[model samples]
Target: MSDTTPRIETERLVLRVPRIEDFERYAELLADEEACRFIGGHMPRPAAWRRFLQMPGAWAVQGFAMFSVIEKSSGLWLGQLGPWQPDGWPGTEVGWALHRDAWGKGYAYEGAAAAIDWAFAHLGWTEVIHCIDADNAASQALARRLGSRVLRQSGMPAPYEHVVVDVWGQSREDWQVRRSTRA
Candidate 1:
């Protein structure tokens, strides 16, 4: 609830503010073509450096940003997933982007659910969105699993303005109901 990034822990993962030490692994994810495809195409190391700093910068400026996901068991860097809302954003969003190696293990779902709960509870967010690429079926499926439906279609901000994405989301009331049902 504080303006600082908080460490969030789930059954199998830890979400905390990113650190400079995470740069290498984080850059690896940014540089992986397949992993970065839906988010943005892979970039060179310098670009990756800027991309890597973006999250921390967001945290500093906005007091909220993506968390560096760590596998609790192995202490591995999975990827980033949490609240994000840059200039001209469609809405407050809880997004996810895991490394290719971290896929297929339900990490995205688990981490995103936690982040959504935090956003609704601590951030006073009435609703949350996921800006998923139209062709990213995997992300679309995850959005469905998270109880979000396609609210509309919108374009991203500059540098990604050419890409049209589906805005999938649910209100806090609906999210709470879904959580209670899951419990």
Candidate 2:
């Protein structure tokens, strides 16, 4: 794997490392009820900061983790999106979350495509997985848009019982074909 951090740019978004300054914007999104519904529910600012500080290290240590998604034109923090390989996970987890206002704009698809592309291109990762809450229709739609196939039905970690989810994945070969066709 390349030691270099891959920077992926979509038409209107920039997927980059999260900094201390991003906490405020990120915290707000994390605390948003609608936005956080699927991702272990809402979290306080302190917990959000703690997670932010640990993400890049996760990426460096495991070769993949969620990254901050920003708007290129305004340089505004939009949300977080990336491929996370959390311990005990079966495959790379493709995840993302955007503030409520950023919804319906196709930002999720744009950011996710770039990050998934980076995962295959830089890390030689053959499969990118998207584990989303079962009821989250939007995310399920987005996973389908990325050409990810549902691999299994699974449950969320502790404190999130009763919330079953679908695990979606796409192989590198499929990703390459999808990207090529889009181009």
Candidate 3:
């Protein structure tokens, strides 16, 4: 009854479930000051695993979940990206994160686009939202690249205010056309 698929490949990255082998690498990235600059502060290794394990259930309930992103050639664990369904959201949301080394590259766009495509194409999702910190310019740009428009600026958790952006997606008919055009 789970729609949680295995690996989904984009142009330069492979989006897949987090394996135990990924813990050390993921922990290293999460612990990096630069990588954690915009998001939550450094996470402990066990906490990271707990967070990763929660994705499958989120996916089962909402039909989409975060995927660990790996570079196809190097097979390095970059970070995570995908659709999330949180409270007060009308639909699923797309989000991304990467290690500092992966910054300035197009991994965010590549992985995010693929997940949006999959959601609209296969999951019957009509829209995707992105909630980003106001100061996180990089993430805002990524949201725009995925064709999302800012919905509002809202508080996240208790302390941070994030800009809420939403992307209206392709209908099945639209997806078919896009697929045909790409082919």
Cα lDDT computed for each candidate against the true fold: 0.93, 0.82, 0.71
Report each candidate's C-alpha RMSD, comma-separated, in the order given.
1.8, 2.5, 3.8
Query: Each candidate: how many clashes?
Result: 0, 0, 0
Identify the leading candidate in terms of lDDT: 1
Which candidate comes out best when scored by TM-score? 1
Give the TM-score ranking, best first: 1, 2, 3
**Candidate 3 stretches greater than 4 Å from native:** 1-4, 60-63, 87-91, 157-183
Q: Candidate 2 versus the native: TM-score?
A: 0.90
Which pairs clash inside model 1? none
After superposition of all CA atoms, the RMSD between model 2 and the true structure is: 2.5
Q: Write the per-residue lDDT of candidate 3 for residues 90-149, one digit (tens) a residue.
A: 456667778888988988888887877776766677556676666777887776666666
TM-scores for all candidates: the values are 0.96, 0.90, 0.77
Give the lowest summed-lDDT range of ten residues in model 1. 1-10
lDDT over C-alpha atoms for residue 8 of model 3: 93
Winner on lDDT (1 vs 3): 1
Q: What is the Å distance of residue 141 in model 2 from its true position?
A: 1.0
Q: Per-residue error at 106 for model 3, in Å?
A: 0.8
